[model samples]
Structure formats: C-alpha cells, structure tokens
Target: MNAAPADQIRLLDVQAFDVRLQQLAHRRKSLPEHTEIQSLTKDLTQMRDLLVAAQTEESDCAREQTKAEQDVDQVRTRAARDQQRLDSGAVTSPKDLAGLQHEITSLAKRQGDLEDVVLEVMERRESAQERVAELTERVSSVQAKADDAVARRDAACEELDGEAASVAKEREVVAGVVPADLIALYDKLRAQQGGIGAAKLYQRTCQGCRQELAITELAEIRSAAPDTVVRCENCRRILVRTSESGL
Candidate 1:
C-alpha cells in the first residue's frame, strides 16, 4: 500500500470524517427522545387495555341499571292498577275488600323491594362511569405524551439527517483525493477491525491499538519513505503520520 505523501495526510481527514459519521449514528440510536418514545408507546398500550376494560364494565353496569329500572317500573305499574281497582269500589263484598287490601299491601312491598334494587344498580353504574372517565383521561394524557415524544424524536432526526448529509458530501470530496486502492484497503480493514481502519502514530504509540512502538519498530518506520504506506504492527491498521506524531 503506497500513496503520495499528501494523499496519506489527506486520508487522515477522511478518517476523521468517518469517525464523525460513526459517532452521529451512535448518537441517533441513543437519543433520549428515542427512549422516551418507546416508553411512552409501551405505556399507551397498557392504557389502551385498561381503557377497554373500563368501558366494558361501564357498559355492563349501564345495562344492569336499565334492567333494574325496567323491573321497578313493571312492579310499580302492577301496584298502580291494583290501587286503582280498590279505589273504584269494585270489591264491595267484605271478603273481597279484605282480599283486595291484603293484595295491595303485598304489591306495595314488592314495588319498594324493586325500587331498592334499582337504587343499588344505579349506584354501581355511577361508580363504573367514574372509573371509565378516569381511565379515559389517563389514556388521553399518555397519548399526548407519546405524540410529543414522537415529534421531538422526528425533529432531532431531521437535524441529524441534515448534518449527516453534509458530512457525507464532504466525505465524498475527501474520498476523491485519496487513491482508490488505498480507500479499498481501508474499507476492508475497517470491516475486520471493528470500524477503525486507520489511526495516528503519535508519541511512538500506535493509536489504533493503543500500543507503544518498541525501538526496533520505531527504527523500521524511521527508515521507511514518507510516501510508503505504513501499518501498525500491533493492529495492522494504517497509521497516518503527522507532525504531532512525536517521531
């Protein structure tokens, strides 16, 4: 691997841009808004389940209340007819009169019992309605939160995407200055080296592997030509040299 001295130095800028791209990708994935949206979505699902259950219970309670009221109405209607007959003097015979009075008393009691049941059912239905209302409000609240999180996440994504696009365009220009073969080698090495294809040789250390170069390794590099491609002996990564290399 060999390149013009200037191309090798230019490759450093290419590598810097690549590192920046990786960092941007990592930041996008780890954004707090992304996490918040996920959590909010999960909460929304749970809230939906709870809301469905509450609605079902409320409906059932409403139906029960209606039935209870219907029963009360039926009993009261029968009692009203009995009282009408008694008041009309349709039972003049003493035995008939006594029987009519007794029947009226029984009907009144039945109506009262039915009314009590209606009241109880009404109370239960009211409670169920309250529960439904509460759950509905909660669902709305959680949905709003989820929506806000999504909006924030999207805004951040758009900003990052714009920056990434700009950086990618710059990379294309940087890549153009570097030799094709050298770029190919860097790409291949990056694939095998955990995304780090190049690093600087600074202070007698291979930054790629963070390993110090021994005297013999330093002597070899010193003897090499400036345009000759150099590799870190430890990590086999292209080691770009600069004035700060502390040769």
Candidate 2:
C-alpha cells in the first residue's frame, strides 16, 4: 500500500507506542501483588476451614460436658433417695439394707467418674476455643493483606490505563495522517505477528526479525518511490527506515 514518507516515518512512533503499551499491560497482569494476593487468599481459605473444624469440636465438647453434668446430677439424686430410705428405717432386712448401701456407693463412684469426664471435656473445649481464636486472627490478618494487595494492584492498573489512554489518543492522531490502505495492511500484519507490524530498518538489518538484508534489496528499498511502503523480506513487517537506522 502507498503511504507518504512522513506517514511511513510516523509508523516507527506507532510501533514504539504499541510495544510500550503491550509491555505495560503485561506488567499490570503479572504484578507481584497479584500473585501475592492469590497466595494470601488461599491461606485465608485454609485458615477458615481450620477455624470451622475447631468450632465444631468445641461445640461437641460443650454438648458432652452438659450431658456429663446431667448424669452426675441424676446419680446424686438417686443417692439422696437411698440415704433418705436408710434414715427412715424403711429397709428392715439386713441384706436389703446392705444392698441399699452398696447401691449408694456405686452411685457415688459413677458420679465421680462423670465429673472427671466433664472436667476433661471442659479442658478440651478450652483448647478448641483457643485454636479457633488463633485461626480467626490469622484469617483476619491474611484478609487485610489481601485487601492491601488488591488495592495496590488496582492503583497500578489505573496508572497504566491512564498512560495507555494518552498513548492511544496520540496514535489515533498519527493514524489519521496515514493512508487507509496502509493502516489496514499494518493492522493485518500486527494480528499475524504478535501485535508488532512495523519495525525500523537498521544498517541493512530488519529490526523486527534481526535479519540482515541483501545489498540489492537494501538499495531497491532505499531507492523506492516516495509513496511506496516497504516491507521486511524476512518478517513481512512494514519497514520504516530513518537516518539513525544507519540504513
């Protein structure tokens, strides 16, 4: 496609701008904060799971403790009834009295056992509660860190977006000066070559692919008409040569 010499020169600026924009976009997506936030979020999830497990265990221990205390109360009530019967001399038979006394002793022993179990359950509940507290704190800390990371990532993205917007506006202005056919060809080549369509020719070398061109090819391109748009022989990208290109 035909493009004025000035427009062809401006293609180099467009190429540089596109490269910068691409780099900025990549940096925004791959920021360290982004990765850190993901890692922290995973940790928060695991901590929450641990806290849930601890709470479940604590609740179970509380229920068990309540049942154990109830068992002790029941046993004490039976012992009191046996004592009252003994005091009233309701059991006249010696053997029956002996059996009643034995029952009282067994109830006392059972009550003691239940009390011991209740104590153990209380201790276990305390431990589980402590674990839950620790895990809860950990989750909160991780969440705060994750929030900060997200904020930082967002700020970085916003800055890059602003810069990109400015560059885009400049590119649009430059595009208006180039021919429609040239812009279409550049767009097509960019899509096919990882968003890089134009490159400067430096000292007989195609900067896009870093391949040296033959002397004859270089002379032909250098002597081409002012409206002719040259392309790299190796990479097929628009070749925008300049005095600084040493071509």
User: What is the C-alpha local distance difference test score of candidate 2?
Assistant: 0.88
- Candidate achieving the largest lDDT: 2
In Å, residue 202's CA in model 1 sits off its true spot by 1.3
Residue 45 in candidate 1, Cα distance off native in Å: 2.3
Instruction: Name the regions of candidate 2 deviating beyond 4 angstroms.
Output: 245-247
- Can you list the residue pairs that collide in candidate 2? none
lDDT of 1 by residue, 115-198 (tens): 888788788778878888988899899899989888888898889888988998998999998999999998888889988898
In model 1, pairs of residues that clash are: none
lDDT by residue (115-183, candidate 2, tens digit) is 899899999999999998998888889999999999998998899899988988888888777778888
- TM, every model: 0.93, 0.94
Alpha-carbon error at 37 in model 1, in Å? 1.8
Superposition error at 101 for model 2 (Å): 1.0
Global lDDT of each candidate? 0.87, 0.88
The weakest ten consecutive residues by lDDT in model 1 span: 5-14
